[model samples]
Target: MKKIAIFENQYHQVKIQFEVANKIFFNDMLEYHQFNSSQDYTPISNISEFNLVIIDISLSSNSDKDGFDLIEEILIQNNPPKILILTGNSNIKENLKKRNLPDLPILMKPIDPIDIKDNLSKLLV
Candidate 1:
């Protein structure tokens, strides 16, 4: 089974949507690990355990780091998991360019459940 990690401050909302999408499109085959803040994903040792990571560019105000920082960290791993960015920020492209990060798949906020499943299908390929 493929594994996924979701990092989003709006945990419940994102979880519920993904759960529905998984059930309908993936037949509950995917395993999910969720984090509400950067700290929740700390130690970073387990980053390679997942097949994909879906991260929100903006996290809780209390976190010392944002998703971009997390992505940079992940990229340094020997074989990083695929990443799919989630953001409400309209300047996502600019922010990514500013950080000199590689092009990554992104899904804007208020994403439709079907879109979520579609992206997942593509990424998990």
Candidate 2:
């Protein structure tokens, strides 16, 4: 069994969608956690418990950092559980290119629920 954590504050739509999708597809094999802000994100004491983390580039106002900064902070904190960035901003790729950061895959907002399930399934597998 694996665990998943989703960080998104935009009305919690993406979080809810992923929760439902994962529940339907992964069943008992995957557990889900949701966070609305990066500042509120506390590293799991047992990092081994979770295997994947989905981060939204647009967290709520309470978050101390945006998606890009959160990605760096997350990497600094732990080594396991691959990270996925979900953002509505299309310019993010261009911005990252300008900074020479790794090209990361992002899930655009208003995405179909089925696509979310499929993407996660591929990652988990």
Candidate 3:
């Protein structure tokens, strides 16, 4: 099974919804790991263990880094996993541009299960 890691701090409901939807649709093929902050995820020595990573732009104050920082760290790996951005921030495009990151797939806030599934399908392909 492929693994997916999620880094989300503020949107528990959205995360729960995605988990349910994933279980219903891709349970046999995908496994999900959720982290509430950078602190929770930073301990993992192998970021490439996951097939994909979903990140929320805004993180809790307790986190040592934000989503962008996490993305940069992941991208520097020899075999970086695919990334999907989930955010409410309107300036996400500008942020990516400012950081010189690629135009990754993005899911805006207030998304439904269908939206998540669609993006997952694309990323997992």
Candidate 4:
């Protein structure tokens, strides 16, 4: 079973992505995503246990750079899962450049399963 983590801020967006993932996946998968810190969407024992993490790089919480903060936190960990960023903002590439982080794989919003599938294939491969 592929363990996938989706770090997203919005409820409806997570629902949409989950639906898309479900279409391509079966019940054996263990999926997770970030929601309000108060609520646990999918209980994870360890962050590093995931096979892949799909992050939405939108402004969330109190920080304008919350997405980057999350990425940095994950990258700091030992053997972090494969990471992907999803964003509607085009300036995100420039933002990554300013921070000196590599241009990580990204998928724009209004995404189809094929787009997600393609990138996942490349990133996981």
Candidate 5:
């Protein structure tokens, strides 16, 4: 079983992500956690416990950095978990491209349930 950490500020988005994953994964098969702030993300800095960490670009209170700061924090870990960046906006697509974060996968939001299931299944396998 793999552990998953969902880092997002919005309740609806977090719920949506959880529902998508739950539909595909049984409860006993996975471990999950969530954080709504950079402050909240402190306890779970070590990525070894999670196989994947999903981050939402738009945070409710922390809207200044466009989530790049969270990305940077995750990168500081000794063995960072695989990252999946979720965003509804395409404006930052080029910006992220410039950064060249090869290990991260950017998933556009209004996320498709099928895409999440399929990609996660692939990761677990």
Candidate 6:
């Protein structure tokens, strides 16, 4: 079984993404962990435990704790999971570049279900 952790501030958006992930994989094969707005993304010690990580661009205050922060944090670990950046902002790549993160595949909001599936399939497979 593969673990997939998702960090999203909005409850409704997280709910929708979970449904999409569930549709893509069998329930037994994939375990999903969800973090709400207030929580930090640093708890999980072993990055290997999660095969994929989907992070929302605006988390909590939106001033701090954005998706780029989570990505930077994860990159410190040995073998970081494949990241799927879901952002409402169109300039997410620019924001990430400002933070000096690697060129990551970012999915813009409102995310298309097919695009999500297609991207995840490419990464996870």
Per-residue lDDT of model 3, residues 77-122, tens digit only: 8889999999988899999999999888899988887888899999
Where does candidate 3 stray beyond 4 Å? Answer: 43-45
Give the winner by lDDT.
1
Clashes of 4: 0
Give the lDDT of residue 8 in candidate 4: 69
- Cand. 5 Cα-lDDT: 0.69
Clashes (candidate 5):
0
Candidate 6: where are CA atoms >4 Å away? 24-28, 37-42, 62-64
**Lowest summed lDDT over 10 consecutive residues: which window, candidate 2?**
40-49
Backbone clashes counted, model 6 = 0
Model 4 steric clash pairs: none
Report the CA-based lDDT of candidate 6 relative to the real structure: 0.72
Q: Candidate 2, after superposition: displacement of residue 118 in Å?
A: 2.2
lDDT of 2: 0.72
Model 2, residue 59: what's the lDDT?
78
- Which lDDT values do the candidates have, in the order given? 0.88, 0.72, 0.85, 0.68, 0.69, 0.72
Tens digit per residue, CA lDDT, model 4, 1-125: 66777766674754665567556744325455555321233233366887887777764564344667667777877887888987888898899999877779988887876776678767665
In model 5, the runs with Cα more than 4 Å from the true position are: 14-17, 25-28, 43-45, 63-66
Name the candidate, 2 or 3, with the larger lDDT value. 3
lDDT of 1 by residue, 1-125 (tens): 89999888887867778888889899999999988888887678679899999999988887777999989988998779999999988899899999999989998888878989889999999
In Å, residue 125's CA in model 5 sits off its true spot by 3.4
Best by TM-score: 1
Weakest 10 consecutive residues of candidate 1 by summed lDDT: 37-46
**Candidate 4: which stretches are off by over 4 Å?**
25-45, 62-65
Candidate 4's displacement at residue 42, Å, is 12
TM-score, ranked from best to worst: 1, 3, 2, 6, 5, 4
- Where does candidate 6 have its weakest 10-residue lDDT segment? 36-45
